[model samples]
Target chain A: MPEFTLWDIVRNLLLAARWTVALSFIAFLGGTVFGLLLLLMRLSGRRVLERLVGIYVQLFQGTPLLMQLFLLYFGLAVMGVNTSAWLAACVALTLYASAYLTEIWRGAVAAIPRGQWEASASLALSFGQQFRHIILPQALRIAVAPTVGFLVQVVKGTALASVIGFVELTKAGGMIANVTYEPMLTYACVAAMYFVLCFPISLYARALERKLA
Target chain B: MPLQLDFMSILVQWPLLLRGAAWTIALTAIATLLGGMLGIVCAWARAGGPRALRWLVGGYVEIIRNTPFIVQLFFIFFGLPELGIRLSPMTASILAMTVNLGAYATEILRAGIEATPRGQIEAAESLALTKAQVFTRVVLPPALKKVWPALVSQIVIVMLGSAVCGQISTEELSYATNLIQSRNFRAFETYIVGTLSYLGLAILVRNLLYWAGPRFLFGR
Candidate 1:
């Protein structure tokens, strides 16, 4: 049996934590872009587009993310498209995050009084112009805190990627525990690392909410 | 070859799937009851207990909130044996879920509790109601009512999260799907069924909570 000092386990977990961070960043960024598009579609006043986006959001939000990852990982491969765990994890997390982000931003946009839309329209502003100049500016302010708060969820969600063989902090801890027979110490470190990464964001989100309120 | 999906290969194992779904519901039900109680206690601690107890509950909530549920499951299942507290997969899954849900519930309930009007508590006290009666009669019902929706959403979230317990070999819905897939090599199809089942369960649980909340918990 390989003897792993506490430092060894901590170091390896920290190294793997980088992937957790990276995956979270990718998922959050991609989710934001896709979520923005869906938000626009929902707000476009086309009933078809609105309903379509609504189903998309509901489908993603309604399911467990682990199943989504499995479907992507195995589903893609079975379809003859070679899919790495990395690709599957990224895509799944991106879609999952997108669903929640769209909902969050939509709520923020919905909070805008109807008069703002009417006022902008009476100014002869196009929908795009109205969204860009008047609606988005106000909505973005409301959306910021929640969006940041969702990043913590993204970080935690990355832990699920480990099941599909992506070696993030959680997976790394499992491997170390297997080899070093230190599940207790190893997983404690894993939990600590996640807490360290997520707690600050959670606290900051609350602070932002207070400040904004 | 063109894409092919034979969900029948998985559906033929309906008994396994049914059992898995039952386990998932049972685990969630037990955890919800236990965790909801834990949340109420912790919320009281945070809202009105001693300062030291408040700090302790605060720490518990923060630690549980920040970590992933999977890691928490792993820790409880694998780590606790070191402390001479060995738990079976089912037990550990329940414990982790209960702990996880309790933390979030505490926060949600505390919000409701804090929002209780000052005059209401004062009025209850002047009526000579004991502290316990005041809390149960004057504060809790309205607080639960105010936060019922949020609590329902959290319960749904926790139910969806129990999917991770399958990784620990808990024989939940996802575990059954994994077994079916491994048996027939119908991974994708099996997962689709499992995922849809989860979505169905989430919707079902949410509606159930919403119905039960007003009917049995806080009055409409």
Candidate 2:
């Protein structure tokens, strides 16, 4: 057995946190792409497309993320796809993040005045051109703060992935606690590391929101 | 070779699954009640508390909201014994959930409280009611009634978040599923059963929250 000191625990946690950061970026970035697609699908003129996307958001939003991770982990392996805990965790989180992001961006886009869209259309702009030139830039401004706010959520959510056996910060904390037999100290350090990672983001989100307001 | 999935083996552990589900519900309910009360106090602090108190509440909410629930759970459960306070996994899980949920509840309730008009407080004052009376009888009800929707949503989030308590060996739904999987090697079916059970619990809590909304709150 290895002797664990405060520095030892923090050092190990920092290393594990790299995975948390990597996974958060993967989920957030990948989810943003899917979210954008879902947003367009939701805004499309076709009823069935819109309805399908609407239900997708509801299914992910209404269910627990932990459950989503389990379903993806087990579901993928059951379907005969090669499944590792990491891949399942990433895919499930991306899907979950996408569902929520789609709704958030959709709301942001809808809040843009209708007259602006009509103006862009009258300028003989194609739908893509109109959205690109006129709408998204403005909507992105309003979206920035909330998007960042949602990022804080994404970071918090990554902790849940530990349940799937990914050795991220929370899991590593657990591992260290088991070895050091200092559950409380090991875990408190874990919580502090998370605070260090997330608290600034929360404050920044609030500042952005205030500026936007 | 094709994957050999076994539902029968998983179903053979149905009693175990039910026990897990029962523990999850029990944890969720206990955490919510305690958390909800803590939230009300924090919320009240934010609304009318002293400047120092407001800063304390603000800091608490920001810290909790920013961090992950798993880390918070570990802090309270695995982290507390270092301070010489030992608690069972069940006790630790509920306490963690309550603390985590309270921060969120405070944020939600603070929003509700802030939205209450200053005019209403003045009206209560003109009636010469004591501050406690004004808060209980006049102000808090309307504030909470207006924000019940957001508050209920937070409660649901807390309910789902309780699943993390499995990490500490509380043998809640997820822990039980993990046990069954390792024991019987029925990974897919066992996990599927677990996910469905969680989804069911989430829905049931939402329904219960909705039903209790008008009865204990706003009906006076």
Candidate 3:
């Protein structure tokens, strides 16, 4: 059994923390891009397109991320596709984040009010021009607090990637704990890192909520 | 090159898949009952507890909310035993889920509690209802009802989260998906099955809650 020092465990977890950050950024950024496009499609008046996006959101939102990851990772492997855990984790999270983001932004856009849309229409603003000029700016403001709040969720959700064998902070902590046979000390350090990463975002979310209010 | 995949083969593993689904449902049911009660208590304490108690509750919520559930599970599963308190993986996972969901439920229910009109509490007091009686009959019922929708949605969230317990080999749906995929080489189909089953579960849980709401709420 490997006896662990406080500094040793902390150091390993801190090193793993970088991957957590990297994964969060990748998932958030990628999810946001996909989410924004989905938001647009959802609002498009074409009933088929809107319904398609609606089902997309519901499907991703409705399922557990863990099962989705398994489906992507083990399921792909069974198909002889031979995907890496990294790719699978990223794709699963990106899709997961996008569903929530799409819903969040759609609400923000809808919050812009019918009057504003009518005003933009009267001004001869094309859909692109209206959205690019009038609606998106306002929607972005409304979207900020919620978007930041959802980032906290995306960060927490990334921990689930450990199931697919991606060695991020939580996964690394598990490995360290198994080797040392000390769960609390390793997990305390794990929780601490997550706190250090997440508390600022939580506080910032509150601050934004206050500022917006 | 053309590749033909046979998902039909994996269907032979029906008994195993059904067992996996059973465990998942059991896990969901246990966690929901325990977490619901635990959450209601947490919600009450956070809303009305003393200053120190409030700090404790708030801290618990913040720590659990910030950290990953997997870490929490690992901590309880392995760590508690060293302190002479042992738990099986399923027990530990359910405990973790309850505590985690309890925190969020407290937040949700606290919002509902705060939303109660001040006049209503004063009215209850004036009517000579004991404080405990008032909380049970008047305060908690309506407060929970007001936030019932959000609370149930959070429950679904936790139900979905239960799949992560597969890492510890809980033989839940995710665990079953891994089993079928490895055995049949029908990775995509296995996932598709898992996804569809999970989605169905989510819907079923939500519908069950809604259908049973009036019965539970009004005791009809």
Best by TM-score: 1
Give the candidate number with the greatest DockQ: 1
Give the top-scoring candidate (lDDT): 1
- Please report, as a residue range, the 10-residue window in candidate 1 chain A with the lowest summed lDDT: A1-10
RMSD of each: 0.9, 2.4, 1.8
**lDDT per residue, candidate 2, B82-146, as tens digits?**
78888899999888888888999998888888888899989989999999898888878887888
The TM-scores, one per candidate, come to 0.99, 0.92, 0.95
Which of the two candidates, 1 or 2, achieves a greater lDDT against the reference? 1
The regions of model 1 sitting more than 4 angstroms off are none
The predicted structure with the larger TM-score, 1 or 2, is 1
Total clashing pairs in model 2: 3
Quote the chain B TM-score of every prediction: 0.99, 0.94, 0.93
Instruction: Mark the regions of model 2 whose C-alpha exceeds 4 Å error after superposition.
Output: A1-4, A118-124, B1-15
User: Can you rank all candidates by lDDT, best first?
Assistant: 1, 2, 3
Please state the error at residue A105 of candidate 3 in Å: 0.4
What's the lDDT for all of these models? 0.95, 0.86, 0.85
Residues B177-218 of candidate 3 have per-residue lDDT tens digits of 778878877677778887888898899999998778667873
For residues A1-213, could you state the per-residue lDDT of candidate 1 as single tens digits? 566688998889999999999999999999999999999999999999999999898888888899999999998899788899999999999999999999999999999999999999999999999999999999999999999999999999999999999999999999999999889999999999999999999999999999998
**Across residues B1-220, which tens digit of lDDT does each residue of candidate 1 receive?**
8788898889899999999999999999999999999999999999999999999999999999999999999999999999999999999999999999999999999999999999999999999999999998999999999999999999989999999999989999999999999999988899999999998999999999898989998888
Expressed as tens digits, the lDDT of each residue in A90-111 for candidate 2 is 9998998999899988888999
